[model samples]
Target: MIKTRFTEMLGIKHPIMLAGMNWITTPKLVASVCNAGGLGIFASAAYSPEETRKHIREIRKLTNKPFGINQILIGPGAKENIDVAIEEKVPIINYSLGKPWFIDQVHAYGGKVMGTIAIARHAVRAAQLGCDMLAVTGHEAAAHGDVATSMVLIPLVASQVKIPLIAAGGFYDGRGLAAALVLGADAISMGTRFILTQESLVHDNFKQLCLMATEQDTLYSDVFDGMPGRALKSPGAEAMMKKGFSLLQSVKSALEVKRMLNLPLWKFIGLSWSMLKSKEGKGLLIQARSATGAISHLKAINEGDEKEGFLFAGQSVGGIHDIPTCKEVVERIVDEAEKRLKAVGKNVSA
Candidate 1:
């Protein structure tokens, strides 16, 4: 293994990361990745502060090794979630969207902040904001990200930012990790690859579907969750593509969002106004505002609504075939990456 800056910086044995996918990254999954020497992140964006802490406690129970928490800094209850992470003393905080005013707070406790970005300007801003590292997610990532592909964005951001960079999007095998390293990232963050693992909470049917898919199976559309995202196109997504069909999904999704946020219109509208006041804040707020279908999509994931709800996935699904445990998944990637890196020798640089 290269044992590059990433491993030393994070005090982990491998330079691999589990990208946070809401609801799908449960405590059991997080512990598995950490135990295997790769960093696993729990996605707390979909949870209330209490729930976030609950999951963190569970992860701690499973492993004493370090793990991270991924939070959407502008999502509903973002501040509260941050508070919970800090209070629980997580080793790392991974975040994206909105101002990074909480960086100082995280640093105070010796916890590092890893800001995720796809575009160049955002990466520069993150570096300037005192983030300890960066996770540059590209178009191939499962959820919301800018148009830049990992091939183009990775090196570009690396050239501009001084902090360590972790590449996300379409990373599965060792060659992908080598490619990420060649592009100037110290580590690689994976989403779709790990989502298929047995430890992941993604539906078993969905995991099988990913393996059967091809690179062409995925697409970027606002139909599934209203904001631009990549996913497997099911009947619900196709129906949403039809004019006026999405509006109904929109209505149904909004009802669920309100219930989840516990907002009673007046409070929701007030928070909306606060988010719109700042340019960066507005972008995140607008995305979340359009995320009506996202809340409903979870129903598809956990409740088996398959044909009627959204299922967020990446273009990488085509490469997934079996549902291995999270440790097996991370271990396989690390093993493959080490073999690939070792075989490449000096020509691979580093």
Candidate 2:
């Protein structure tokens, strides 16, 4: 097996991770990854606190291996959901978008906190904040990513931080895994690649679309979720880009979010105000757009509504063409990485 600090730190057999894709990384998918020897991160941002607890228990029933939950710290229910995870003594808690104040709480229970960062400077800040590890996202990633690609971002962050680094974005196969290690990452996180697996719950229609996509088939824009992100070039995605921000749609979408989370009107308002005042200071418009994006994301995953829905995808979609089992994907990547590494060693000697 191709072991690295990521594998040793997490007590997993492989230095691979299932990137947390909101709504896509369900209990089953997470468990499957853990069982396959890679770290699976349950996406807690899509569910309420109660739902989060239920799913955490469900994953436990499915696998005894170490696993994690990924939370977007700037949103509502983030604190509540994270509280539930800590109460359950989860193995790892991964967060993004904002600072993690509960690092000590997690570490108190012997759980590790992984910070996800898109910027090189943010990697340094996260390391300083006691993050046990960092998931460095590049611009080629699915969902939210900033300006730098993995090529520039990985080595840059590696030079700045001493903690284990998980390279995310544009990674698909063994070659990519080998390259990530060579670039100084401890492991590689794959979202788009895992989404094509048989264990994934993504609609077959969207899977087919991903198979047909080229590296150029993605569009990056703020319209996807009011924050800059990358998504597959679809009719819904294109329409959103043309339509721009819509206040009316955002209000309607925010209401849907409130109902989905089972939050009372006052509580929902409080959360909204808190988000605005948070360190990120995303404001109401961004939250509203995020609501709209969440609904569309559900449509794409649950109903496969291509015209009205869009799925976040990375440039690596072009390299994925088959729907293999999670175990097969993991094993294949490890085998390929080993061979590639040996080949590189031979070349150096030659």
Candidate 3:
């Protein structure tokens, strides 16, 4: 009875969503989150068209519940991955980095498109582009924020967009969800909080660090991925800060993402340039920063070198202390939310 628009809109039992973390949200993890009553979002940015489908099938095999896919539209093979998702008739497609040109296609299939943005302007752009929902991520989010924290960004975007909004960043507890609802968001998405779940497949070392973190432990640095993203203060970030951008670094970083996507040279070059051209303004500068920072982004996923690799994280890491199962995590937050809502209702009645 404490349902929000998120539950009604997505047709899910709970309002919580698992943010797609690259190299971390495996099929097992995705299914676990879904089974636990939260919307599980698989990170398809790390996979190709076929690989994405395979994992989607794998998750389906584990649970009959609905789950979404997170697609980083700026990376190479992004278009192809989007095509595959459309063809497969995925339930929800969450995208970041660029405008979605395939919204109509997804709409035809009854699929929802949700754009993730850290800044208010981007949120407006996402709504204009016909996204069904907005996941308003803030600077306190683990990765890639232009500006604005959750408290400011959510309400700003909510004022502009007609669709439902989900708040991300600085969210890991029932209090965060209550605050987001008060701010006009229908629900909340959990990145760091989901990562702390037992189902996540990340490095134990990194997980340990996350457990030890506090809200103050996160730092925003362009050295992470040629863009300002939030993450735990680590030695890798420190080293990258010492180095600066160069043409060689730029090409290398582009190639790393390309290799991951298995994209041909022409498509890779064309799309990369296209994103830069469309973004224009400060976006071009953010794209340029990728030259020195991109390698660290990809390397961090591979566990190649912590000294050079950067982990995208959020300020909420400090608020987390244990690795609960996905179901427990979801139920805990949802239950708390329901309790608080009912308590507030009683006060109103009184």
Q: What's the distance in Å from true for residue 343, model 3?
A: 3.3
Task: Tell me the alpha-carbon RMSD of every candidate.
Answer: 2.4, 0.9, 2.5
Query: Which is better, 1 or 2, measured by TM-score?
Result: 2
Q: Which run of 10 residues does model 3 get worst, by summed lDDT? A: 279-288
The C-alpha TM-scores of every prediction are 0.92, 0.99, 0.90
Global CA lDDT computed for model 2: 0.93
Score each candidate by Cα lDDT: 0.79, 0.93, 0.79
TM-score comparison, 2 vs 3, better candidate: 2
In candidate 2, the residue pairs with backbone N, CA or C atoms under 3 Å apart (3 or more residues apart, or in different chains) clash, namely none
By lDDT, the better pick of 2 and 3 is: 2
Largest TM-score belongs to which candidate? 2
lDDT of 1: 0.79
Q: Look at candidate 2 and tell me the lDDT of residue 142.
A: 95
Candidate 3, superposed: residue stretches over 4 Å from native = 280-306, 348-350
Off by over 4 Å in 1: 243-252, 263-266, 281-291, 346-350
Worst 10 residues of 1 by lDDT: 243-252
